[model samples]
Target: MTPEQVLVAPGRRHVYWHSALTVVVLVGAACLAHRHWPVLERGAVRLAVADQGWLLVGGTAAAATWICAALAQQGAVVRRLPQGRLVAAQFAACAANHLLPAGLGAGAVNLRFLMRCGLPAGRAASALAVKGAAAVVVRAALIVVLALACPGVLRFPRLSAGILAAGAVVVVCLAVVPAWSRCRRALAAVVADFRAVHANPSRAAALWGGSLVFAVLHALVLIAVGQAVALPLSPARVALLYLAASSAAALLPTPGGLGSLDAALALALTASGAPGAAAASAVLGYRLLTVWLPLVPGLVVLTVLIRSKAL
Candidate 1:
């Protein structure tokens, strides 16, 4: 086979697999929606009577998340990326995020985009790690601050002894596991990139600031939805609930935290004193603005990026 053909063959295979994965995810999402149709239908009915002004606010917040995400992605690396494509890639990444569990789809898209933007494979991976780490730190910090500020707003659920024991065992196993040489090298690379990012004031600000705002905007979206649905909980309380619930849902590897986040958010809202129906309405509105509304357009952007070889 010619060298060029050999090079092109792997790309073709990757595209095929990517397409197959997308199709599977779409099918799975459809099945999930079908299974939960009753709940969704109720939510939709509630939303129809919700306050339009608050819904618009939630929609605006949702739209801004993509911009913040793009800024964070750009800040992860030193080199300047094509701004337009970078934003477009983030938009596409959000859609991909919902297509797979544990953020694999979004990560894959961002990694490919970074490599296409002239980053080496290792560096691209390191950049993603840096961005993720920043996001985690920012989110955890926000949760703590909100919890403190809202005093008594968040009630921690009691864990069974078995669950506690399992968690302990998992932590111990992780601590005791010896790292492979390659894993160690990758860790070192990520640390190096993390330090490099922090050393530059502008990049550091963008990385951390963007991460913080990205999380805050998401919480705002939830809070706005709560208002739209006339939820009794205060905005601060709602934001706290959202942050805490989303953090908990992150433990479960669900596509875009779909079922997991929905359940958690509704439960949190209900637990925080909102009526069950109101909580459900809030969750539905949040999802409508953040996920369902953007899904089609985001997918279209993804397709365009792929066709243009910008991803």
Candidate 2:
């Protein structure tokens, strides 16, 4: 076969596979929506009569998340990135993030954007690692602080024997196949990046500050939604519940934490004294502002960026 033919064949296969994956994800989402149609309808009806003012507040907080994400991304590396494209890329990345499980889509988009900005592939990957680590730390810290600030707001659920056993098994399996050298090297690189970023006081501030604010903004979205639905929980309590639920949802490798986050958030709210219907309504409104409302526009941005070769 000619070299051109060989190269074209793989590209064609990749396109076909990507198309198949998109179709599957869309079908899955449709099926999920259908299965939960009754619950969704109730939530929608409740949201229709919810406080519009608070709903608008939730929407504003949702929009700010992308900007905070961009700030954290910039702070991940020492070099400067194009501000406009960085914000645009974060917007597009949010769209991609919901299409794939875990954070793969968002990570891929950011990695590509960084490389396009002239960062080497390794450095780009490390930058992503740094940002992700900072995000985790910030989220965990917020959860602790909120829990403490609002005493008795969050109650940890009891783990079943089966779950405990399963977790132990998984831990043992992971321990059996430890890649110590690779782990050490990756950790070393991340530590070095952390040191380099902290060397610049501004970068350090942006890194930690952006990460902290991003998580807080997300929690604010939930809090506002709860208020809109007239949930009895205090704002501080609602934010604590959101942080706790979302942190737990991260364990499940669902796309943008779709099913997992929704279930966890609703359950947490209910367990924390919110009425079942109100909890569901608040969760629905939160998703509307953060995900559904932005999905189409974000996709358009993604398309524009791709077509313009900006991604």
Candidate 3:
């Protein structure tokens, strides 16, 4: 095989391997949790859902956030994604993230969608990579914002190391080699693409709008989770906890950051004044609401996109 073919071959193989391992690991985790799984399930079923009114409020907020995030994602693509298609693509990503372990399936589906749009695969890859990096920046900002906004975080010493390590890493990634040049030379050649997609105020508005809304809804999710666990933490604490835990989960290799999401959330909450069990329960519940809730829509979107040959 040619050199380009060699690079392509390994990536293809890795994708397949990651996808396969994700399925295997999920099954294994489930089987291992068999006995305690029931207890955990039962315990989780007893989780207190906020009042119907609040649930409606929460659900609406969440749905809106998803829509906004969809718009932001669409804004990233130079050739704009149709409203329906954009929403569908995001839902597919979300679905893949939850059901698939490796979390790259979302990127995989997205890359294919872009390719079908006549955009090269490299550009598609870069757009997603940029978003990934943006997420990292957002994460750091969240922590810093929380620390400055919520002085209460210093009360818990347990989270000190994790938070510090995270801040340090974020600084390095953004400050050091952005890696964008090395990542997408071919895509970078399309100079007008970014201008076409991002020059207008509307696109920036959409992205900032979505990102801010995402943060708000995320805090609300944490509040709902805190309520479920009887944690009584403030919104500020929850926000910081959310960022910190998610950042840690991003470091994990597990599909969708499953185990790590829960574990990190638990630790962060505990450090933020929540009891371990309750924090665990809250994290579990939030995952149910935030992660699994959009899954059905995602699957539907993916199926529709595939039928339309978008992927």
Worst 10-residue lDDT window, candidate 2? 1-10
What tens digits encode model 1's per-residue C-alpha lDDT throughout 98-132?
98666777888888899898887778888998999
Clash number by candidate, in order: 0, 0, 3
TM-score of 1: 0.83
lDDT of 2 by residue, 147-253 (tens): 88998877768999999999999877765675655666667888998899999989988989989999999999999998898989989889888988988877765
For model 1, the local distance difference test gives 0.84
How far residue 94's Cα lies from its native spot in candidate 3, in Å, is 0.8
lDDT accuracy of residue 123 in candidate 1: 85
Position 35, candidate 2: lDDT: 80
RMSD of 3: 5.7
TM-score for each model: 0.83, 0.83, 0.74
lDDT of 3 by residue, 151-268 (tens): 7574435668889999999877855675655434534534444555567777756655566667678768767656655666776788777877777677655667776666677668
Residue 273 of candidate 1: its Cα lDDT?
87
lDDT of candidate 2?
A: 0.84
